[model samples]
Target: LADDGSRLWLNYDLIKDAKQRESYAPFTKFIAVASDNQTLKIATEELQTGLLGLLGKKIVTVKTATTSGGIILNVNKNAPSSANISNEGYEIYTEKGNIIISSKSETGVLYGAFELLRAIQTGKSLAKLSITSSPKVKIRMLNHWDNANGTVERGYAGSSMWKWNELPHRVDPRYVLYARANASIGINATSINNVNASSRFLTAEYLEKIKAVADVLRPYGIKVFISVNFRSPRTLGGLKTSDPLDPEVRKWWNDKTKEIHQYIPDFGGYLVKANSEGEPGPQDYGRTHADGANMLAEAMRPFSGIVIWRAFVYNADPNGDRFKEGYAQFKPLDGTFDPKVIVQVKNGPIDFMPREPFHPMFGAFPKTTLGMEFQITQEYLGQSTHLTYLAPMFKECLDTDTYAKGQGSTVAKVIDGSLYNAQYSLMAGVANTGSDVNWCGHPFNQSNWYAFGRLAWDHTLSSEQIASEWIRMTLTQAKPTEQKISDMMLKSHPIYVSYTYPLGTSHMMGESHHYGPEPWLAKSARPDWTSVYYHRADSVGLGFDRTGKLSNALQLYSPEVQQKWGNPEQCPLDYLLWFHHVPWSKKLSTGRSLWDELCERYYDGVVQVGNLQKTWESLKADVDPEIFENVKGRLKIQEKEALWWRDACVLYFGEYSKMPIPKPLTPPQ
Candidate 1:
């Protein structure tokens, strides 16, 4: 039978090995739950279904286990532990011949249930099962850019999963599947609409539609949030002006918030994208970003929600640097925001480039809670055609030392609230999901979504570990086949960076669509939108100079960071072009001229894509035919597009460098 890829990583077919099935048989006799809440009920049902498939035996459900050799779910408010488990943390151990999953809350028990299933699915020995885990960040979520009209922004998959026309009455079973997939991976919150929001969502008619979706997801412990239009007071309500300081505007928002809570009492708070990319904001009325965000925060104060104010704003200054705009706008307003507001900053200073340095705003806001926004949709990284695993990309930013407090102040510590002892912390990924039968478009793209959730729960996991686990459960469990696929997934992102944006170059994608390379593009509606604005290739050099002589953007980092990246010689080769503009003839630390190295990377990337294709072809006998052919077909497209990116960028920059392609690397025809 061919796999349609509908069942994401939760594949639980009967264990082929009789010995392995026997090892899991002892714990499959029954599942006991002490509480009967909705979350616990869902956990019990999930365990039962998973066990029945894995062990081929129906597990009995009971309030309490009267015998040994059964799995038990225990909720103890005062569980003694060393890991300092939070309300949503879980501890699973073997006690008295019974596998015990204990937590302080029902939601924790649900998380533990999934973890226990993961251990069994990954073929771990259960003889001495002892695992204690908790989420590093408090709020881990996915921000969907779906529109009310059933279209999605930057969505490579099919149309929106939500059927807005049939909503509020006939709910799709896919919503439950979506919730289960998210809950299994530790995602607890989601914003279900685009940041470029529609005001109709605030009306009573649409609140009913949102409530229906929320009710289905509530059992899985997933809270629903909305991306709100900043000018709702004027659009939704008949207010004269949408100023933050206006009394009528405040009243309008307060009332609307109250009405939304009535439909879904546990709604997660607003995700606002005001004054960014032509979106309306407080600046239109002569107010600061904090003034806009604080007003919304005040209204949500009566509830347990928060306001996620986006810091993705920038101006179209042909003379000024776009890299410095986001930090300059919100860094000064750090201490001014209300307690319920978290200033959400992207992983990089610029938009979601494949390879970018950590955003300067990460550790700059000491007095305010900062949230990390990562894009998993692959909008800038080949969309659905190429396979790009993003765990390494995420870790690159998370593990970088911000030097906010001292030498060890990594971005992970700042995001987890340990560096600043912050009141709240969150990590959100721009969702890649749609109505595709496979969930994500490419079979491999699902790994990026899975990686985001796993890292969001615990940032310390290595990319290799996540890849191996995903491969074992989602694909073949054969160690040899799994290792081959794992290697491909691990090297995908860097290989993509090599051809697309080698050596810290940024934003050379085609206009608007942002898919293929358009390195020769020189004109756009805004200067920053043009490819030349970022690459800045000229007779002398082939990169933008953000050094003191020009943009002075590197000064935003700490002095410790400045010392490392300030000098062109001392900076890492990966980031050399991002901070400094060197001559084409200049020698790099790699023992090659600057122009030669760039050609080498771009050529090497195309060769690497061919290697990936060969590896996938060798595993055709081990993988599902549907999935194998799907990935194989996409790999062909990847190789074709890799050539496109390599040729365009090399030829475009070669004109400025006035140098022939290196001897070993053939020049594009």
Candidate 2:
């Protein structure tokens, strides 16, 4: 993964262009800077490394630095002067024949410096450049969900990156490496433990270990948070009750937070998954989600820390669809949460499936803050083997019109606080990183991490634009190859959904691991965990009818939303089955019956995989063999799985549809 993803997008290779390099080269002849701080030292060293590689000539330190027609990295006098830069923001301007990369902080200068180098690599002319930007969201963070046992929850790769046994004393190189990777993508905050947390982390021993990692990440402008076990006071602190409003409980949290700050003053905060997923919560003591969040918020407020309360609640309810549970649970608590508490909602009502309708909470809660929680690890998608680019998946949800305020209530606007008029907003990605040599196991999986950061920074950036920039920076700067890969990436999510679960039919993946198709699986004791519970597939047709008659899940949305999605014709094609149950013979707008449409989609997925492989092959000349072969290999796996999906679905649904295979899609059997 490009040196195990240690360098990420900070790779500063020499310019492949003749003219731009010549223009930038003359400015590199002399270097003079007015500062001698450690951050400035890092900035200078970064320039040397990037310039040396890009220019193919090492730059000797000039006794004095100036902007007299030379590349200058100038920091504004009033810029944020500390170890932290806003984690990710920078400005680059080129005028008067001099390129000046400046920011309010040293790390900003570092980011700007790298951005300038990237512009050069992409062959963008540098004669005139002016840019100023910061992250669109206040918190562009990654939730590790990594356990102290070295195993990660929902981790597809081998194991977690944290080496708990040898921490605080022996800092592993992976700690620094992981920090660098996160910083490269502008991720500033990391919760170092699983949200389904254990109480062992609160021990002084483990806090010391986290402190070491925090120290390493400090310079990179990354802060560390912990997923505190809700029952920590009772389970570990020898307390009788864990009630949030209890004075003793409040005192316990205050002492705990202060102790944490003592070790790591810049600690991000706590992420609570209370009363959710069997984890102990305030509900156990008859307190509400807001009460639980506010309790933690009170503990963190003194330190300016924010508590990220997860809205991913679901019980083993036998009577109700799990999709409706989250909105039902949190919708009543609007305007109830403390300002320091941000509700973290998953991208989908269910889990992180390949394609999901936007969560209902986006435009619903106008009074309280909410955060988008995306799974970078492909839990429902094909883990590391599939070449599914998730940027498009993110875009589909972010770009959807929630229409809470009539229109233009985009999910992006909702999370950015503009729609809700809230004070703070957040975005979190369930991290996919691990101990694999390539970090994410599959080379292409890194794109999911990269895409999450790009979207977190600016949800306005189109998925295509993000993909294009990613391909150029991560693979090669060639336009043709970048466009080709971007095209493949753009079509990846839909193609996967078409082959895997089309027409909004979902929860059909293989039981347990959710690796492959198992649409017809029977129910376990917990209805929510079963595929049959979600799809409701039968002889009449496939899909859940959430209209007034059947599931009636549509009631959660606004009347306009109910009117739009309440009908099959008006509902988006992606969500057609999520709300309706049409006959197999029902004609889609494509002039094909539901059966034929399904067959077409299955075959279309197969064809798209071939097209994607061809697209990747077209870039072999420009992409390095190390990275090219990695993605090529994964694309082959995707091709095989696409066929598996097509075969399994056609075989299973052919029984219900009772339609002969189309001439173009004749099965081998």
Candidate 3:
């Protein structure tokens, strides 16, 4: 009952308002469920638990829908289907004074049950509830960058949630809680390890451990997927070469796939990160990406499994633009991939920066099933220290007009199979979850996870709406508090971006850890890894010239997209620096010189963090003391880091520009 954030958004704490409780009590008189499936059982139990907590009364469970004026869960064979609603979709309507949840499958009933509980927790009117909903994408998944040794790669929320040391014998209750949290938000599949995978996970020893985790998640309609090291044949089975064309290598993977199925029959196949960041792949054997992916796809095809091959591959080419690497590598292999293989591409062409144009690969691959991969973890967006609700960022990418099919071809349509008519569709988020007591480290960080799941379920949902729903369910039902929190969540991303990488000047953070500002870093193991490689700051100007002159990266996009972002004078100010290198004294559309504008943005960004701190301080009396203080402390750290970023970048860049900081702007201390 303590507000340690361990409950996440499933916090079905008793409603303190008397009138609200009275209003919900009528529907909690009795619960009737007709299905006997494990999923339905969990649904029934969840509804019962939620009703008891919210309405302060225990509801009786009935075998039939004989009892009226209570919640009824039934699987209807004919449910008046629509294009928007699939077999997994549910219809919840109030029929004859009884709330009826009708669906074609038991999984639909479970999702409906969670939706009903969400409506209650958010204090929505259940009197005339008529909601028919289905997921926009087929496979909504979470990619955890957690290693087997309990150390997460880009993870900031303590250690890995899947404790490898305590496996099949000791099942942690936390694992079940994690499933419940993900299930509540309609997340169906999860890749349990980092894409930079370990070969040990393929062995019999680790299969048992994975099976234990899968058993806990199965009841919640969530399947476990593993990130497989491509050279598992050589590393684990002692093969001479892990070539896709080699019969011995193919047989090794076939046996391994069969062995994996033996432990967990419903395992969602492998997520591979090959030939990127030093990962071994088919390229090492003079084969294409399709060769590597098809080999795994064929092995998993018999079992109805899929191979999610990551398209985040890039070379250490000093002259090559990192933004163009993915498009160049994957464009030719558009139709070459097997039917079961879905190419997982990051939302941005480069790594997950604070801001980026939508990846050109989104609409380019007309024949391939292109899945959108978003990083829910704050890898480049200030990690867990800064409070950045990424729904707005995610929506920006999803809503961008790729112009692939002339007028209104958005990225969402492409991934949802509406644009390209692909056979399979998936949207994955690099998970921010860990072994932290609060799940995500920061209290506000929980909102990013909630937002990712909500947006993945329905890309059309607005960021403000998602933020409001999360605030009401997790923090407070108070209207004023809800509005304040929602406003903060909406503005946090832009504010963080302003101080750090304003106007699309990305990858300015520290080289290795990617922590603070380091625009001066010119040397690293690889050219693309350094900050100077991206900013391209010289005595004349700053920003990478990705237009026609330098890399011609903009040429990869459709002509319509190129026309929109090509011109420096007409381009959106937010993306100005991303495409063109402007002189320090050149005037922008904002009527200020480039140097003055940059300084103002950096200084103003720090001020915005101060404003956020003030807004949060006003909620001290309204929020839970523990959670409130946790966020309060993080805001202080955010302010300090925001200042650190402002000072580091402005001073460093100013050194190259030879321009004085504008007098109106407060110079960094």
Candidate 4:
């Protein structure tokens, strides 16, 4: 195997363990599928191909299932006993010496096929296999910040996966493979263009191109979505004013949406990033976010479409706490949005820092359908060089108790529609994929994409379980290798966090690129974009005070959450700096002074990176040489950058805290 990672986790390499292969070979006699739907055809072919590759046995395809040993895939529309399973959910079990996969729809049958293959590839026994699963979130989607000019904003992998010039005439075969990869993980939708959006995509020439991409993905049960420019009525249709209330503007949108449906009938509606980051929206005409979202939702309502309106807006006020901006802007507009509209909120209040408290909007909007937006692309984490598995980061936010309904009201429950009883629910990841040969730049980065899909399907899954499963299916089958890689993945996020922004410190990266450390950055286009605006380091103390005395941002959360994070003495150390400004001499829960604790974390972080390198190096013989070397090289860069961040922050923050670096700490070189 070349190990280029172009195959992603779909690598159906032959099983090397003879005993394990022999045990699974008996069930590889044939594949039985009754339906001739395109999705089912793909599923049937995938199973046949995977079995032949994994077991070295060609399985015959039959029209209907038989009693003998084999795999049976069926769409059971009226299985009253299995009513618990949803339309997109499936049940797989062994019956009469054969494997049976049953679901209510063809898409569910396809998902079960992939699940069956995953179990076999991961060395799970199929002798008495029984499993039933369904997606927790209604819409598991990917938001690609890819643009019409073939550039990806905040993307580290490469240029856009979409080739704008060649589409509609020359479709890339990779598009079909991309659909397969997404379908395998239960991701059902993707917004194909950048949210910053270009009006050119609305032109007739480009809609045809988009239709080409959608055609390839439709068979895999993945619907295509587009990010629409709010000013498209004026920019593309030559309208006078692009106000949501204006009849002309509304008619323009309605006609355009109808035109779009003609080409791509199953088109999933618009993703609008309006009135934020200089993007035009209804706000330019003095209208609210609900006004903007409802307008677009109405346009697509006839076609069963939706509008995913982003809530990532904030004013660049020098005195304002960015943490409070999202909640303040949207809380008052609850229940105003149309039923087809969903408010897309980011995972954290601040831009995707290495660590931050969950956004307060999760449980606040009881009347609005809230969708979670997690950055799968490592924009603030370390881009493409450092390997940081984000499952733990996402899990931390999802599992946090919002205390909205007294207790156990988790952010996961809110976004999955179990908390608010909302009509629609969604979970979206800012895609890390690009034109890179490996899809995501680093091979291990692919794990983050896999983790997002798995967690989206079932939020209850532990980060360790997802890591172990990915390691077994993609990297190695050896138990020791699986354990080692899983351990590395489990620890990678915290290690990166410690060295970069320990104790909830955030927005300390370089201004525009957001690549490396720049704690000394005092000036930028906006005060909120500067490092000083976040840390607020001064002669007497460090950290921004979000308590009632200062910004009063702590009041946004319920009393239960406020009590947990309001007091510096009781707040989790990981979130201390986010809420309080502690003196250099103040002792923390860890028994170390504030200054000493910061130094310890930075030093410990670099040491952990070294250990990760050692661990990966030790697995050279057990893993593919290409992958081992690729990760090894990236770890070296990570170590160097970790030292850079440690040195920069310790020396810079020390100027304000007026404390010496701890005696045992080695100052960054």
lDDT for each of the candidates? 0.91, 0.80, 0.91, 0.92
| Poorly placed runs, candidate 3 (over 4 Å) | 77-81, 666-669
C-alpha displacement of 227 in model 2, angstroms? 0.9
Q: Count the backbone clashes (under 3 Å) in each candidate.
A: 0, 6, 0, 0
Please report, as a residue range, the 10-residue window in candidate 2 with the lowest summed lDDT: 1-10
Model 4 Cα lDDT, one tens digit per residue, 1-669: 578999888888888988998999667788888868888899999998888888888889898766578899889888775545888999999988889988988999999999999999899999999999988998999999998888999999999999998998999999988998999899999999999999988899999999999999988889988999999999998999899999999999999999999999999999999999999999899999999999999899899779999999999999888899989989999989999999999999999989989999999999999999999999999999998999999999999999999799999999999997887789999999999999999889999999999999999999998998898878888898899999999999999999999988889998899999998898989888899999988887778899998999999999999999999999999999999998888999888999999999999999999999999999999998999999999999999999999999999988888789888764433
Top-scoring candidate (lDDT): 4
Q: Tell me how candidate 2 scores on lDDT.
A: 0.80
* Predicted structure 1, TM vs. truth: 0.98
Candidate number that wins on TM-score, 1 or 2 = 1
The predicted structure with the larger lDDT, 2 or 4, is 4
Task: Tell me which residue pairs clash in candidate 4.
Answer: none
For each candidate in turn, the TM-score is 0.98, 0.94, 0.98, 0.99
* Error in Å for residue 458 of model 3: 0.3
